[model samples]
Structure formats: C-alpha cells, structure tokens
Target: MATQTANALRFLSMDTVQAANSGHPGAPMGMADIADVLWREFLRHNPKNPKFANRDRF
Candidate 1:
C-alpha cells in the first residue's frame, strides 16, 4: 500500500508538472515516500472539505 501510494504521488506530481509545463518535479518525486507515510500515518484532514477549520493540513 505504501509503495503504491508513493508511486501514485510520484506519477501524479510528474504528470502535473508536465501538463503545466512549469514547476519543479524533483521535490514531489523525492518526497513521495515521506508523503505516503505522513498521509497514511500522521496527517489528518477531511477529504470532503480539506480547508475545514480544526483539520490538519499537509
């Protein structure tokens, strides 16, 4: 699951950068694993309403 999540993040970031033709992809690619762990273990936010008050961001 973690590996899948990391791969998803990496590809998504790369795709976004490619589509926009801007921004740095290295940051997202490098942090994919960390992001996967955090999203799966530490961070907490409402997927339906991410900006909701009292919910953790990032």
Candidate 2:
C-alpha cells in the first residue's frame, strides 16, 4: 500500500510537470514515500469532509 501510494503520488506529480512543462518533477517523485507515510500515519483527514469543524488540522 505504501509503495502504491507513493507511486500514485509520483505519477501525479510527474504527469503534472510533464503536462505543464515547468517545475521539477524530481522533488515530488523523491518525496512521495515520505509524504505517503506521513499522510497515511499521522496527518490524515476525512476526504469527504476535510474541513469538518471538529477535525484537528494537520
């Protein structure tokens, strides 16, 4: 799941950069794993209600 999540992030980042022809894709590609871990483990929120009044902010 971690690998999949990281790869998904990498794909999105790379795709955006490729499409825009600007910015560095390598940054997101390199940090995907770290980001995936952080979001999955410690900084999560309800996708459907990310701005819920009672939820703690990341």
Q: Against the true structure, whose lDDT is highest?
A: 1
Worst 10 residues of 1 by lDDT: 49-58
Task: Summarize candidate 2's per-residue lDDT along 1-58 as a digit string, tens digits.
Answer: 9999999999999999989999998889999999988888887588898887766564
Model 2 spans with C-alpha error above 4 angstroms: 54-58
Off by over 4 Å in 1: 46-53
Per-candidate clashes come to 0, 0
Clashing pairs in 2: none
Candidate lDDT (C-alpha), each: 0.91, 0.88
Alpha-carbon lDDT of model 2? 0.88
CA lDDT for candidate 1: 0.91
- Mind giving the per-residue lDDT tens digits that candidate 1 earns over 1-53? 89999999999999999999999999999999999899878887778997888
Instruction: Find the candidate with the highest TM-score and give its number.
Output: 2
